[model samples]
Structure formats: C-alpha cells, structure tokens
Target: MDYIANYVDAIVIGGGHAGCEAALSLARLGKKTVIFCLNIEAIAKMPCNPNIGGTSKGHLVKEIDALGGEMGKNIDKTYIQSKMLNTSKGPAVHSLRAQADKVEYHKAMLKVLDAETNLTIKQQEVSDILIENARVMGVRTITGAIYYAKAVVVCTGTYLKSKIFIGEFAENAGPDGLKSSQVLSNSLLDNGITLRRFKTGTPARVDKRTIDFTAMEAQLGDSKVVPFSFSNSAASIKKNQIQCFLTYTNEQTHQIIRDNLDRSPLYGGKIEGVGPRYCPSIEDKVVRFADKSRHQIFIEPEGVETNEMYVQGMSSSLPEEVQIQMLRSVRGLENVEVIRGGYAIEYDCINPTSLLHSLENKVISGLFFAGQINGSSGYEEAAAQGLVAGINAALKIDAKEPLIIDRAEGYIGVLIDDLVIKGTNEPYRMLTSRAEYRLLLRQDNADIRLMTKGHDIGLVPDDIYAKFLDKQEVIEAEIERIKKVFVGTTATVQSILMAKGSTPLTSGMSLHELLKRPELDYKDFAAVNLDGPELSDEIIEQIEITLKYEGYIKRQLIQVDQFKKLEKKLIPENLKYEDIKSLRIEARQKLLEIKPKSIGAASRISGVSPADISVMLVYMEQLKRTERANDASVS
Candidate 1:
C-alpha cells in the first residue's frame, strides 16, 4: 500500500481539550506541530458537560491560562452564563464556573487553533507510535501515513479502544458516537505500556421545550460575572446571562432507578472498567446514598441555537426505555423528551506512574501522555497535563530543562504529583481537599504563581508579562503604603468604624492593621481614605488577600520551604530499589513500580512508609559519599 510520509517537530494524537492545548503550546513555542483527530468537527468538544471550571477544576483552568493555554480564554469568550462558586467560603476555595454554549465553545477553540502559527490540524486516526532504541521516533496513522517527529504526545483522551454501553447494548465507539481507535490499545500494550480500563458516563440531553421550568427552581448567573482568564477583561465577558433550572430526584425517581439496577451494565458485572467514585451513575447513587431522600439535577442548555438541554446530575447507563421513565419520574422532567440517551464509555488508559512529573514517559524518551489516557476525569485536568506535556516535549527537543510544577505552586502541580507519584486506581478528579497548600494556590493568584514560569519558558508574550509585573509592583506598593499610613482616632474615623459595625479604635493604628480585622476590608475604609494611587480591582484584590491572610500565608510558606527540601533530594534514575535490604517488601515493589523522582514524592505514595523513606534517604547519602570517594581516588 502506498503511504504518505511527513515530518514535524512534534505530533499530537487526539483533538479534545488536551490535544488542543498541547498543539497550541508547541506551535506558540516555534515548534512545527501537527494534531490529528478522528473528526475535525469534534475539536475541543465537550462530550459530557457543556461547561468548564468547577471547584478545584477552576484552579486548573486558571493555571492553564497563566501558562498561556487556551481553555480559560475560550470559555470566557463563549460562556452563556458565569458565576463565582463558594463565595461563602474563604478565597482559597472560591472558584469561577461558567455554563458554555457548547457549539460556540468548540468554534472559539477551533478558531484559536486555526490561527496558531506552525500548527496543522488534520483529520486522521493515529494507530501506533514508532520507537527506536526505547525513544519515540514518531507515529503512524491508520491510513498508512507516517508522521516522524522529534517528540510525540499521545492525548488520545477517551478514544482508545473505547466501548459505550447502554444497558445490554454495547458498541465500539467514542464519545458522541464517534469512531474509536481500536488499533492504538494493542500498539500501546506491545510497546511495554501498562493499560488500565476506566469508565465514565454522561447524562442524557433532553429538549428544553418539554421541561416544565416553573416546576423547578431557577438558577441564575451572577449579576457581576467573573472571568476565568487573568488576561481576559471582566467587563468584556459581562453580559445578560441565561438561566439553568434546578430539579431534584424524589422517591419515585429512586424507585425507578432501584427497580432497573439489575438492568444496568454497572451493577450487572458487564462493565470491566472502574468508573469514577466522585461522579457516579444514578444507579450507584441510588444504592450507595440510599439514606438520602433526593438528589439534585441541573438542567443546563446545550447552546443558544439548540433545544438540547443536559441533564447534569443524572448520568447513567440505563436502557433507553428505562432512561425515559427515569427522566419522567423527576419533577420538572415529568414530560421530558430525550434527545440523546445517557451511556457509559470505557476506554484504555496508561498507568500514570509510567510517566514522570514532567509528563514524559520514563522508558520512552520524547514520548508524552495526557488527558484521560493518564486516568484523570475533567477537561481542566486534561488541559493542564497537555500544557505540561507539550511544554516539556518542546523543551526536550530544544535541549532545555523540563518544567515541573511542584505541589505547593498550583493545582496543576498537585494534580500531576498525585497522578505520577501516587497513581490513581480509578479515574482521578481534582478537589480542593487534595491540595494541602490551597491558600497559596488559589485560582485568583494563578497568574502570580505561574506567569513568570510561563515567561521564562517563552510561552508568555513579553508585553503580557510586563503587565503582570506592573500589577505585582502596584500590589506591593499599596501594601507598603497601607502599612505606614496611620489613621487617627478622630470622631470621623470612629463614626465610619461604627457605621461598618467594626469596633471603635481605642488608639491610632495603621490602615493595614485595620484591614486585617475580620469585618473590615480595604473598600470599607474609603470614607477615611488615605493618600494612594487608584489601583485596578485586580491589584486591590491581591493586596487585600495578602494582608487578610498574612499569618496563615506565612505559616504555609514555611511549610512549603520544608517541602522544598525533600523535593530537592532527587532520586537517581538508575537507583535499584531491590538492593535496599532495609526496605519492606511492599515498599520495594511499589518503589520499583513508581520510581519516584524525589523523597517528597516517595513519601506521598500509599504503600511506601516513613521508615522506607528514611532507609532510602540514608542509602542515597551513602551512595553520594561512595561516588565522592571514588572520584577522589581516581584523581
């Protein structure tokens, strides 16, 4: 058979959120990159949900934007409704979530990819990765075309040997009924990669006109919308928002699901793959949380032009007839018309432990894996991994140091560390509780934590980086001015304090000290304003957060310093864990399997104990001394 041959700097397989970011990052960095998708129309498609950024997932999107990725900016441009979640909580957990016009979101991302320099988007299925001497050489398409590159990033997402199950019926297909790549799974297994089968489901899409909106509570977008991207202007994204209806599943809905449990593929022992524990199917919820009286269901619009509405919390793999019955049992959805049936998709993913913190494969140099293929669950998680993998793949080809985001820096760091160091048994989802340094890694300050790294890596434009620096300078100057400016205990000041319900000042104090009070914020003191330049809201936010959490931030920073020490203690790539006699049998086996990059990472692994870490540290120190002695003797 005749085959076409092409060459590029990098090749990205799959065109979902992960592949889009990877391709864009590589192209922006001056690398000629090609991203192949099974269907071009599905580029950046949201198969499960028509929205982005929720809880810790928002932090990932912000970090991706800070590092010059496109998800945040795209969502901001195309969102139909936007809101800031967890407002009642501290700034650490506050997240920006937005409901997107699914079609517009895809169009916006596609436009960005199209405009990217040195990037070529192709419609093709990648069948196998080519390797030589355990290093990635390129990838071959199913059509017999070979694409040779310096590096190959597999962002296949949930398409590798994918199977969709709806009750007793099963078919080899990807999300939204797209063709699955059947040959890739075999190719991956043949290349010494350990593959795991994982399952995830999407809720049915119903016609909006059929839903009884008055019967359900109306959920409106925030009047003041918060943009996800630091670079995006909040004013530009603010607009009249759409409404999402909230409905609940009652005893009748539960009874229907309970009666159909035996018919579900999940309960029938038909699904071999492990599904996500956090985002479970309706059947799982009915059985597990049986004590609960009801479950919340969100009816979200798919797009402005379409009548399709996503049934948010009712993801299931029930039979088509049962699904309709299940939908009708709910309050507002009593007469709902189903547009698309919910189903479970099982796909082959590589064991994330096979990769390094940089997201590059340990055995196959220049090869990278991201997205669901890494066992992660959300679009944000996949995009974050894709950005890291793309950046590191380009760095490797350029003979530069690979970029690794540590746990304390951002949610991206915590996510990669958890995946590569502490491998997930099921599909992993990022949560605020997973990150110990959430205060320091807040979504609001993602730019502050990562923009400089992006600039240093050549992804951030010089002008944008200069703007970030200017914002930082303004924040610092305002903080200093506030600390020095003393407010007298005059009648006017006391009255202002009294109006704010704050305690009257007994003596004169710096404005900074007053700002530290729980009830008083920077804006509250405008009545007795001190001299300072007017600042952007962004700058003021940073100043306020820094002052308000100064004590807690300091403590976390101290913890970060301690963490840095262990992280700096690098484990030798060639070190033999089997040779350590003091290590427990399980610890040795786990260590050999994971081959952690540092002492900090090793300590986080489940089976590895504190005693194992201590023994490994001592052995490392002895090895260093032996190497030093040998060098001296040779001299």
Candidate 2:
C-alpha cells in the first residue's frame, strides 16, 4: 500500500514550539514547506510550565521576536497574567514572564500556520528520513506515504520513542498522552545519527474549586503590563490580569516524599534518562537539599476555561497515593482534589555536538536539528533553535551562505555554541550567567541587537525594519544631545539634588555624567533640565542604559574585538588534526570529530587545550608557506 504522497521544498518533522517556528520561517521565505505531527491539535503546546519567559528565557523570547519569529507575538495575544521579573536587579537581568492561556495560545499559533500561503500542516508520524548520498531526500510517514522534499528538519521534541513513568507504572506515550514516535529512532540509528535519552517531568493539576486561597499568600501580577513582541506596545496588549497564590512545602511534606522514596520510579532505577539538573523534581530537591526546612510552591491556573491548577514546584513521579499525601500537607492544598497526577517522561534526543553552528548536520548535507532534539530543555530554547534551523535550511536551498550567530552577537549564539562545541551530558538550559557579555545582551535591547540580521535574512518586513532604524537614530541623537546639556549649581538644581539625596553639584556637569550617578536616572535628569525633546519611554530607557553603563559596555566591546580575531581565522575543513604532533591525543580526536570551522570554535571544544590551538596555528602557517614556495617555483 506504500505510495508517493507529495513533494515540497522543505519538510519539518514536529509541530511543537520549535517545529512551528521552523515551518513558519521556511514558508515565509517562499519555500514550500510541510510540517508533520502525531496530532495537529498539539501544535505549539506548552506541555510542562504554564507560562513562557523566566530569567534568561525571557531574553530568548524577545530575541525570537526580534528575528521575526512568532513566539513573542503569540504569547502577547494570549497571556492571562504578565509580570516583569527582577526589577530590583540591573536591567541586564530584567525579564518579562507571562502566564498564558494554553488552549488559546495553541489556537492562535495554529491559525497562523493555517494562513501561511506556502505552509501545510499534516497530522502524521514521520517514521523514517530518506537519505541519498549523505543528503536528505524526504520523509516517510507511519501510514506508508512517502513525502519528498529538498531539505528536512528533525525537531522531534521529547516524542521519539517516548515513555511515561509514574511509580511502577509505565506506558509508551508522549506529553499529555499523545502518541509516541515509535520508529523514527530506528531510522535515525540506521543513518548514523547518534541518539540519547533525556527525561523531564511535570507537576500534578488539582481542581481550583477544592483549594483554599485564604491559607496561601496572594501573588499579584504587575500593575503595568509589558509586551513581549517589539511591534506591540504596552497600550496595545493591556488586559485585566489574573491572580496566582503561593504556598510552601513544610518538613511534613518532605517527610512524606522521603517515606515514598522506595516507591518512586526515579529513585527505584526504573527511569534511565538523565533529567535537567536546574529544574529538578521535588524528590530530587528533598534528597539533595535535606537540610532545608521548606520550599516555595506557586499555584497557577492552566487557562480561563479549565479548572485545573498547576502545582509549579511539586513535580514528582511517586504513586498517586503519595502525591495526594504530599499535596494535602501543603497549607492551601489541605483538602485539594487532584485532577491528574504528575509523571516523568523519557524520550530520545540527539547528541547536539553532531550539529554545525547553523544547526545543520555536519555529515548530512540537507538535514537540520533543533529544540529538545538538540539537548536543550525549554520552549524558548527550542523555538530559538527552530528559527535558526529554518532560516539556514531556506538559505541553503537558495545557494547562499548560512547565518551563523556567534557568542559576541546574542544569547542565541551562546546557546548554540555551548551545545555544539562543549556538548551537554544533561538537558541544557539557558541562563544569564552563561553569557560573558550579558551586560551588553540585555533583553531590553534584543531588537536593537538582532533585528537588522533578521531583516537581512528576509524574515523581518520592511516596515518593521524602518521603525527599528528610526528608534535607533532617536536614541543615538538623544544621547549626544544629553552630553551637551549642563546643569550648574543654581538654587533650583541644588534643591532638586538635595531632594533626591544626591551629592550637591559644585560645578556644572553634563546630563550624561549626572546619569552615571547611582541615584540619578533619566527621569531625575529631566526634572532638573527643562528644555528637552519629547521621546518615547522605550527610546529613553535605551538612552539611559547606554549612558549609565558606557564604561562597562566599552570594556566588553574590546573583549568582543579580541574574540572576533580568532573567529575570523577560518580552519580548513580537511585539516589533518593528527598531523599536529604537539597536540594531545584527546585534542586531536575531538578536533577530527568536530571539524570546527574556526579557531575560536575549536578553542571552545571541551577536550581541545590552549597548547593544541598553538600547534594548530603553527601547522596552518607551515601549510601556507609551502603553498607559496611551490607557486614561486612554478612562476
């Protein structure tokens, strides 16, 4: 019954967050693309957390929006509650997080997918990826239909041969009981794609009516809302935000988990996949931090239509009876009724070191990988990878150079470079601490940092690009204007400074220099200096940050210059690493396997040492000298 189905310019193998971005980007670039999933209803599903953007994750979301991706816009349209986290900290760590209406988020994204002129959404399980002469040909579905394509992107996020575990019970399924991709792992093995197992867990959902809100602390959303997408302002996306409650796990709850340790699948050796270290289950937390007296738990609504309340910090894999016992032990959940128990899922993912900087496979010419399949753990991480992979796939078909974002450019670059160069033994999560130039890579300036690149790739529209350019010019002009506006020790200026508790100005100082003071901000400067151009809050914020951190920003830019020198020194694809006698055996093995494109990338490899880089530089110079001598003799 096997037959040819259809042919397209590109094929995407999943429909989750990563797959959605991948499909949309390819189609928008004028490529005929088809995205396949086991169930179309699961497209852009948020299986684990109820919200998007937290800490470093918020930066990833804004970066996606800046790159003309859909995640930021979709979240803005559907969020029930939005908050800006870390206001007390520096702007570099300030991130916007929002609790989304899960059902509506999915519907919004699906509508966009359906509306795309060149994109097709198919409900099918991609069982095999057809390869011819080390290049992708197409994919075959479980129903024996072969759909041909010029390029393929494998974004099978946590579904390839997925299995769920709760206590001693196990079932072959994906998140929320969706169908597991059964045979794709075998097809991947057949083609020499290395696969590994990674496990992630979700907490139980209890009925909201059964919980007592009076016993918990009321956690309120921000009074002022912030939009995730650069195109939308706060005024456009404002709504009545919902409220969430916070509770805590006491020693009694910890004791309940400790008593059930023997019955837990995670500790009983029933689950084999490595889980994320950063977002560990309650069981892992209790066992690891035994001395701690309590842990915080947030109760959040799943959606406006659903009564299910997600227990944020209580993810577990114990028996249902133990789960109930632990839930009831918390303050507000004393009489809570569990709608569904939490479970851990183990699924197949690839060794990310197999991918190039563009998310393309080194050995497979037209094959790309992204999201959890690349060993990353968050929705934002997956969507970021998908956007990059989709853009690279289209560029490859158009016979253009690939878009490679390096560590100096943005957080996306740091995420990819960490995964492909160093490789991860556990699921990789993005953190602000991971980026060396985080001060310069703040979430507030993501559009400034990346919109031009997105426009160059043809994803950003001309209208949006023009707006960004105007905003950039306004910010630069204001900064220069502020540098010339001086405030002397007039009675009015001294009174304003005294009211703000700042050091009294003995002599006249430029507004830019005054902004460098820890106490004085742009608003404080405006209060002192009367005549200034009216600028939007967004532009003013950018100018404030630039003047406030000029010295630090300049220092980081110098570091970036030094880093780019090594990056610009390209490595020959066919260089014999073993020929460098000074290199360690382990270094040679790693370099030979990775075939890194630049000395900067090679230096970041885990096994490659500084001494090995010196040897490489010397050997490449010798090769150049020999080539020049031969040319001279021929002349």
lDDT for each residue of candidate 2 in 381-491, tens digit (9 for 90 to 100)? 999999999999999999899998888878999999999999999999999999998998999999999999999898899999999999998888888888899998988
Q: Candidate 2, 327: how far from true, in Å?
A: 0.9
TM-score of each: 0.98, 0.98
- The per-prediction tally of clashing pairs is 0, 0
What's model 2's lDDT at 206? Answer: 97
Report the C-alpha lDDT of model 1 over 318-386, residue by residue, as the tens digit.
999999999999998888999999999999998999899989999999999999999999999999999
> Which consecutive 10 residues in model 2 have the weakest lDDT in total?
520-529
Cα RMSD of predicted structure 1: 1.3
